[model samples]
Target: MTQENHQKKIITNEDLFDHISGFKLEVKKTVDDFKSEMKESTNDLSNSILRLESSVEDLRKSTLEGFDMVFKTIDDTNSELREELKNDNIILRKEMNQRFSVVDKRFTIIDDRLTVVDDRLSSIEDNMTYKHQLSPKFA
Candidate 1:
């Protein structure tokens, strides 16, 4: 009976060693799976960062282009307004000159009428002097 008990103890020790080996394999497989998952997460994070950089660059370009277009439009509007003002000024000057010419013509007509009235007054004065001289001879 002692020998049979010793043989059973030996078999139990061998089974324990087999169990420990299986556990070690399972732990190694779990560690390898964890490393793969970590690598996949790192790759995903790197890709996300790249995409963010691209989006930021695109927004910057778009903002610059929008500002350029706005400035260009303002410049074009200013030029057009300047041209319109210049044209209006020219037209006003022409109208003012024409009005001044008409006033000068009216003044010339008034001067001619005044000269005729002065000549008639002188002739009436001479006639009155001649009539007075003839009446004095009767006295």
Candidate 2:
């Protein structure tokens, strides 16, 4: 009976209130710490996202600049090639015209020589016919 009485526990109102108050304080502290850690983690994630976005934007700008340079180079090269082709075409036309003029002059000279030779051959034929009619040996 004495051991059973010693084993029984007694709780006072003041002691219970104090214990409950202390437990409430500990729980509030734990909750505040958890909220603070979550806030820090959220801020870190946001910063990482911002950095990734900035890197992507920078890469996009660089790629566009590179493309612009390539297009400009192509345009400049095309313009130069077009101008060169035009000049070559002009030069070729001039050379062909000069050659054609020289050919025309040669043909004119040949035509004149052929006309003179034809006249001479006609005169020789007339003289041969007269000789044949008078000599009577080529009838």
Candidate 3:
């Protein structure tokens, strides 16, 4: 009876030890799985952040390029307008000079014709006076 009781106590202790070891192993596996999932989540978040940063950089570049193009276009338009105005002013000045030249020439011609008429009238008057004086002396 003493030997049988000793054997039964030894078997119970061995079974209890096995159950405790299995529970500890299961707990360790669960903790390891949780750590792996957390690492994957952190990696996914980092990748998302990197992609968002890249997108923001692209947007900034595009916006700057658009602004540069707009400024260039405005500058080109302003230069073209200045050139057109300068050309118009030059043409206007040339037209005014031509009109003034025509008027000056017309006035010079009129003055020359008037001087010729005055000279002819003075010559005729001198001849008539000389003829009248010679006739009275002959009579």
RMSD of each: 5.5, 3.0, 8.3
- Name model 1 segments beyond 4 Å from true: 1-24, 111-139
Question: Where does model 2 exceed 4 Å of error?
Answer: 1-23
Best by lDDT: 2
lDDT of 2 by residue, 1-139 (tens): 8877775556678889999999999999999999999999999999999999999999999999999999999999999999999999999999999999999999999999999999999999999999999997888
Clashes of 3: 0
**Model 3, residue 23: what's the lDDT?**
89
How well is each residue in 29-75 modelled by candidate 1, as lDDT tens digits?
Answer: 99999999999999999999999999999999999999999999999
Q: Candidate 2 deviates by what RMSD? A: 3.0
For model 3, residues 1-139, the per-residue Cα lDDT tens digits are 9998888777566688898889889999999999999999999999999999999999999999999999999999999999999999999899988988888888788788877877777777776777777789634
Using TM-score, rank the candidates from best to worst: 2, 1, 3
Scored by Cα lDDT, where does model 3 land? 0.87
Displacement of residue 97 (Cα, Å) in model 2 is: 1.5
Candidate 3 local lDDT, residue 63 = 93
TM-score per candidate, chains pooled: 0.63, 0.74, 0.56
